[model samples]
Target: MPEIAGYRVSRVVGTGGMSTVYLGTQLSLGREVAIKVMLPEALADEVSRRRFENEARTIARLEHPHIVGIHEVGRTADGLPWYAMPHLPRGHVGQRRLTGDPQRVREILRALLSALAFAHARGVIHRDVKAENVLFDEADRPLLADFGIALRRGHGTRVTMTGLAVGSTAYMAPEQARGQQVDHRADLYSVGVLAWEMLTGELPYKADDALAMAIQHAQSPLPKLPPGLRQWQSFMDRALAKSPRKRFPDATQMLAALERVPLSGGSHGARLQDFAYGAAARLQRLPKPAWVAVGLVCAAAIGLGMPWRHLAEDVADGEAAPASSASSPTDASSVSAAAMAPGNGGIADGGAATMHGAAPLSVADQAIERARERMRTGRLATPNGESALDSLLEAVRAEAGHPQLAVASTALLDALGESATGAIVAGRDAEATHLLQAAARVQEAASPSASARANHRARVDKALRARIAIASRRVNRTDALRLVEHARVAGLPDATVQQLRAQAERIPDLQGRDPGNLDGMVVLDGATRPLAAFVSPVSRAGYARFAEVTGREPALCRERISLLRVLDRRDWTTPGFEQGGGDPVVCVSWKDAEAYAQWLGQRDGYRYRLPTTAEAASLAAAGGARIVSEWRADCTANCSRRTVAGASWRTDSASRTLDPDRGYDDVGFRLVREL
Candidate 1:
């Protein structure tokens, strides 16, 4: 251990299970570097030693900036293997989460993906791509490190019976976890898991043990991601698919997918930069008095400059006696003399003296007096409990002419009404509803002259009418439909309209069929282009998995495109997509899928979009019935089947059959470009 040969060891920078990383300087080139030396125990095994040496040599051949640069590799004085790499000045990937801005996350992914694409192109597969393996440089640029587990082409079966999986459990692709042969697609899967963790702060799958986790990855469906992530879901889903072929064909494809995410609008990087600059400018413009107060407080805590006794004496001389207090004549004369003392220089020279004889209060004293008065009357309590309501009433009476306060009072009353309406809808007792109504009335009275007061009253009436409609629907179907029609004229949002319609449709009508059947049904063909103008359908399993990952309901989850394709002309009226262009968009990633659907709505006259999960399940069930075998029937029949080459096709009928001879491994889908 006489300082590794050819390098001057400075200090131990980091240590891992099999190696010790030291800060070093290469004497030959006068360059700083990180020297990683394999542990003696690991080197004791001849096979492990050979593997380590081989990996180090393999890494040395990599030349991408995003990949950690391996400068040299050789044996130490005692025959131990050691390798030197460029020293990265920045810290680990986990450190970036403190700010948790999405832009930084994207930048990290971009660099990592670039590195992966480079390696994949060179026929190298880095089996491990988790956050911990990714390092950051001084400029917050990401650098991939620890290629020890990387598998190179022509490397004969390196699997060992160590009982430990090759990749980290959380980021392992399903096939990899099952000990199946893996390719570059496995690496892409790991990157996808890492990206999901960075953006949403949670893994899509979790279990108590590694075995359970492996099972989840192998058998369980990809989880539904967070709502509003409609843009990221498709990429994430493809990357996390249960089968290797279902994932990106290779790292290059994944990189292209990453590029397609909408980064120009609402980009996390631009927003954060704007926020930081604004905050810095605001800090610079703070008043001098505030700065002085902060400095004084800090100084006082440490018993540094300025005596407490002197500070108290100055305060006493500057503050006037309270109007309710009577001072003795002798004491008053003493105070006057103290203020006029020659040692004080003059009234103009000392601020304390100027206020003394004038009987004017210091700003600090006035502030304290006002605070004390407010405390006595409890006027500062917030609007949560009993004190809040009392304070609200007083504020309204004191500032009746102030439009803002008047509006605030009215808003509070309206919120109360809404809460009551929720409780009633949830099946609370009549007594509880009566109590809530009483509370709303009292709040209404507090701001009688305000415009909000009228709004609150109107809201209460609407809630009552809604409740009546619900009651009528349970008893008489015809009347309920009429009531919902009436509500429509009053300007309800589409969701509300749909809900009302759903309720009316539920009752069995005169035709002997459930009236709800007339509301229409949405059908989705997974292989065909997604419906351009209907609610996007998702598999029930997909929806449940998504909820588990994001902690949000399926309905709230945003839709995304699962395949690469243009919108059909017929699908322009979907919920979220509402744009029109005929370009062959390459990066039209899944999250953008939903936006495209919504955009289609404006081009066409009806709603067009991805089917909801319920709709997707129904369609799948129907298709499943048509095919007489397991959906996983070998790739020969269903060309659209999830497989590596299937990534290219928008749809492949050859994939839909049960006969293995007729299947093709590369079939999948693309959304319709137009109706």
Candidate 2:
């Protein structure tokens, strides 16, 4: 990696057209950081360099918790300017599974909007508010990143490439797409697009190319939500208004509007209306004797009409009005019949059955009520028969066709979604997969319409896919294989399951067997023969033995200190942390690992060497959870550096190249025997 003046550049984490992001260490104070270095091409342009520096300075001033803070700014040896930020390893919001969980969706939006509101107050417009820019910290709190394209007030847009659109095309607002002078509202529009994606698992607009997408944002009508997501429609409508004026005026207003969004698929009033319609339809089927009874009740109600408005007020306030006062003639007849029926819980106890008297509470109504109670108590799907899911299933079996069924189903789905989200946030992929499957089953059983079923399944599948993607990155081979089959059983599309299976197959499986007794090594099946590899990085005790036998001085250590490299006093034995004899050694150079490999090969009468990149990748994927990165036998950049594969305890990144002769505190190596 090209040396940045003040930061110890590790390897490239991501690369874009204008810049590269490095997972780096800030030598001063020993901090792990992400360093964004402007590409030499972009740096060569005086305007681009100036714009980068100016935005870096401006964004550095933003100190909100949800905003990625710029720690220090400097230039590389080649004079490419770079800035450092806290290295957040939970990945970006784009990688998270957030569909069907409005609580989480709202939480993310609120955090981002709070960040935006803070920046907007200082006259900085993020310009880009897409999913990729919203990153999560280790705690899973979101931080708005990459404000390189942010526009500050009074700075003409010409500083950026003039007439060329800024911001991601997929999330661009109408004004941004038109390249018109924009304000904070444009960012709000982008957030609206993001919200739509989170709720629907697809972008609001899709096209063949960026230009087409931008045009759609500028001209196409806002897309209607699916039937199950209609509660968010009004919120989406105002948030995605094509005209800037029609959109939420600021992040604060947008936050307020998001708060107002109903938690279910439909509004309470809408549910009430559906119930009214369903009741009217059923009323026509009443027998003549029942109609006569209703007529007498109506006469009695008219005799006491003055109390009707007060009863309506009480019911609207969620307080149960007295049955005699609240019930219309029709409701009185329905209640009288319900009072005589046999049921369970609230209905059998005569509590909810007589209230409102809109309809008789069936076994389904009691079961749904129990489900709601279970949900409130957080007994979602555990403890077997007493779970909210169990109650919901009972309600489904009863097939009472209660208006509350729709709301109850949505609530269960949302609860399961939120729980699954919590599991994902906690890095429990297996648990998350199980929860999503539960949600899918519930949707399958409860959703009546083909479209509703499809929509619900799609939502569940989106979350499962995201969870599976996360597992693909960090889970072991066994877990990956399990998830592949689990996903198939969960009824995900066959193509998706097949693709996941294919990816999981890349991770070598140990098949539930312990590693061979060949010095804590595992024998992996090979194309031609068996290959034995260390299941963990070479330990301190093992490396010490090699060094003692060879009588070689510890490889020259050079740690990157702020603005310069200094000879590090620490070595494999004292890598700045207390270590067990079996603990993996750090501060060992690739040369050290290679030398030990040669020594061990001679001693064991076998060819032992650093694993090849492909082997390393497979091993890394199947290594389970690890904190140290391992050196691989892959050379890069004229053999000056070798590949370091695996995730560090602090990062979710895959692999990077480092100098083979220099030891890093967190880098080690594992050996593979060529059989």
Candidate 3:
């Protein structure tokens, strides 16, 4: 393999407008990375070189869960600026068509919005926010990349290229297409275009050339939303507004809109309003005797007037009046049933349900009360197999008459989402997956525009997504088995299904198998008398487990262990490790490594710490240069990133003390902890 700057080139992964990306492995970090080398032709131009370097520096300043991470920024001997980022195996969003489930597409868009918001908050404007820039990690998690035309506050746009439009033609905002001044809203506008493309498998506008396309975007009427995506018209309208004032104010506002989409109807393609109002219309058309009989039956089943009808009626008619004092809540029958809920948790337990001092409860309140109880008892689903999530979903979508209950519904959904998480922690992946998928299914079927429902539904959907994202990150030899079941039931992706099954067949149950392996652990004297060190260095397998268990990646490791960005030297960057099992990790400062030890110590209830000077001496005596270099917790001469003992990674390689503030790619450490 050809080696450049110590990275062994594997093969070409992709070619971008200004660079040919090579899949390479950093020799020191042992990580796979996409090295965006300035194209051989572009290298001749200083401006092109500056632009290449600018992108690297721009991305290096960002740190977000959803943004692409820049690992290293450097120049080749030929003066071409190249930077490395983690190579996501799943590829970019524009490269892959959105199929199978619309919910997943929403998630991808949500991630984009999140990334944009994060960048915008830091004064970064991703001028090019197209589908091609949104890449997916190994677990199908989205990562925003390619900030080539991005602008950070105080950094002027390229004035030299005036009148020449930048960014992708199909996704550019009208202002950007017209070479007019634009801000973060332009990025959001592009996001809208991507959303349209993902849903309908085509951009909102198309033409024979960039100039024609720009004209179309600048003046043409927006194409109709896809047949099923009519509910998204309002969002699309705001996003594609001709004027910047007409578009969403920023990424945060756009994210809220995206979250409220709820697949715009439901899983089976039915609008929540239609279902709720249809049910209400039925109640009104029925004979009074039949209505009373049916109400009585539902009351017996749920212990309340099936007040969902009133909520639907109120929502269907924006001018519906509130119940007046003279009418009394029970007598009004005009208020949403939720407005008339039994004043204190509903009277379904003993007597006729009635609202006293308070307004009647909304359908949401009843669901919150019922679902809360069921969730507490681990009754995610009923004995007859009815999902409690169904009630919770239906309730949250039906507007609550009172603001407090509306707030309560949000908290209730949080609790239900928490319960799903608890299931995962309890090692019941099947149940957690089932519950979350059930909630997602029920949630997708409804999209009520009421502020209460909109806000609460967004919150609930967030919780479900958190669990799924967590599961995706923690895919390991053991957990992969469990996650496959989740992917299948959730229908999140076929890739995850294939990934889990492939991992189960390939990776073996390795570390932590024995009670005293200590390969991935440290025990301090605080917890126990005797301490032990790892039998070997920490491995890629261990890093995977650490991230999964802690919901965090290690700090400043040379090996990019996770998909998320890491902070270093006033720069937000990432690592790129191809694979390192049994091989010692490098590029970690003593402080960060020590922090990891402390974190594990507290989390696992053990005393984990970096080896002291004496301990390191003994280890080195036994191993005889076993490591590229080892870090000692205490300083021999100076403090603050001063190394006490260890051989350096350089060819001059005599044992020497070095600054700890800086990390050498070949310098790794082992842990010592109380047993």
Candidate 4:
């Protein structure tokens, strides 16, 4: 209840294993604040203390608006450590005060992903991304919180123990479940799963225990989803893929996918309600088959002459079809058969009888045929000696006789193969590859006589070998060479193998560099100024901000204010400016950095951006002289001196800088812009 460090801790708001969060108020700013105090147990252990210190240092370096801001860290009278952050008004999504509307869910998810993308760029991985870790402001804007299990590059020691997965099991990525080394992709997977839950009100996977859930994540298929999620199925499939490479590489890409899904429905609730009502209405309606059977039964009973006049009258009236003469044998027989059907008289099994006869073609068939005809007339036109390939294929498939079908299919397949080869010759490699693969699958599936089948297979084999050679010449030379060698050993034609080998030889070795690097590069704005910072290497101090800013207890208010300014200045650049690195640079909060990066990108050519936490670490670890010097003992002394001159700085002569033996305070940074 006592006031300290310009804030009054009213009461404990929440508690975690390492710290207790208190609802507090900043007297000067007249704003609510959330203060977290390190548990006494953490302070008692040296390793835990170091980790706590590192968390504070890492949190202070991030400068994104979507991230929770770290205001200050101090010690209570009893020597317990605590840190202050902006008080978020809204609680976790799982608290269930009222079910949030879909729009709110989507908005919250978008903000969280954006924040995560920022943190990831700077080499920080929030191993725990879940509803509980996200908070909302008074206006309901989402703020990503709780980076307790965040992993920093070049920081080998983990805050948590081995075999102990840090994130909620429901959101853990497959690799994380397996306890394998993970990267930014794991976070993307979690975001995707969370989004799925928000939309459908269900998790993609579920189990009774953590280990079982992990196993299910690794081995089981995705849970059966409600209808109408087909649009998002492809993205979900990729995101939930067991392999990390298959998921979107980061949260930014996942955000792009989410944006692509149209938000046409007013909100999730309204759409769901409409759908439910529509389904109920459909169930209430009389089935068409029942009516058809009823008509048939009435007609038959009339023909049988069992007080039949009324039956005939009813049947004719209901169907609006002309009544048949009872004297005609054909009409009588047909009527009797119809009446005996189960749907009408309950005498015959209508479904079985209907199946015995050739089923009438549905209206849907006509629609499909019309579409096909239009396509044929437009893109598949036969002109100037060119034949319509799709038309030919359709005609072949429709042929009644096996021999005729075999001949026609073979001809069509051969023509497609030639077309594919022509495309390759014309230097359209992508089209050629697609065409060849399609043709191969078609030929393999076609039905033909044994001799014809063997001949077609031979032709396809030669074409496939040629296509493989062409592909090998383009890229992936090693894979191509192995394929060629395998084909040769399998007794493929020597001429084809030789051609493949020759093509493979022509491919330049682009090995060691990533083939997908160009695709992965972020395009930033040209008009915006790019802000950049560096992260500090994580150290083993208690998970308290006091350990980060002061490296020990501060004796004067001047030192505390200086630390605040340092943190405030850290927000100048956005998270997008940093690239992934494994070393520490200037760290700011995630939310602040995201705002700066976004603003800069908008003002510039959209290329001005912040580097992810991972990217920042990468640049730092690259060992440029400037970066290395920025973290040196000499550099710290120089920076400290410069700050004193540049600002109205104060120092306590009686108080000494704490832990002079440790190097945690040597973090520094620089800024950059695209040329």
Worst 10 residues of 1 by lDDT: 579-588
**What does candidate 2's lDDT look like per residue over 1-675, in tens digits?**
978654567788999878888898766357899888888888678766776887687777887789988766766777777888889888887888788687899999989987887788678999989999999988889999888788888887876666778789999998888888888899999999999999889999999999999999989988778756766876888889999888776675566456546677454345444333233223334543443343344335435642332333223233334655433323233223232223322223334534344455566766776686566445678768998889889988888466777877776776665555445433456776777788777877775345545554565455455555544333246666665655665566788788777766754454554333353455453323345676778877778888889986776455565433344366776677666455678888999888999998788577788887766534643352277888888998899988988777645668888889888878878888754
Q: Can you write out model 3's per-residue Cα lDDT over 430-484, one digit (the tens) per residue?
A: 6676656654554354332355334444443343344443332332345646555
TM-score for candidate 3: 0.49
**TM-score (C-alpha) between model 4 and the true structure:** 0.42
- Clash tally, candidates in order: 72, 0, 25, 81
The count of residue-pair clashes in candidate 4 stands at: 81
Tens digit per residue, CA lDDT, model 1, 533-586: 112122223233333554532221112333332252211122133211211122
**TM-score for candidate 1:** 0.39
Q: After superposition, how far is residue 399 of candidate 1 from its true place, in Å?
A: 62
Among these predictions, the greatest lDDT belongs to 2
What residue pairs clash in candidate 2, if any at all?
Answer: none
The residue ranges of model 4 lying beyond 4 angstroms of the native Cα positions read 1-4, 45-47, 96-101, 157-160, 264-675
In model 1, the runs with Cα more than 4 Å from the true position are 98-100, 159-164, 263-675
Of candidates 3 and 2, the better by TM-score: 3
Sorted on TM-score, best first, the list reads: 3, 2, 4, 1
Who wins the TM-score comparison? 3
RMSD of 4: 19.1
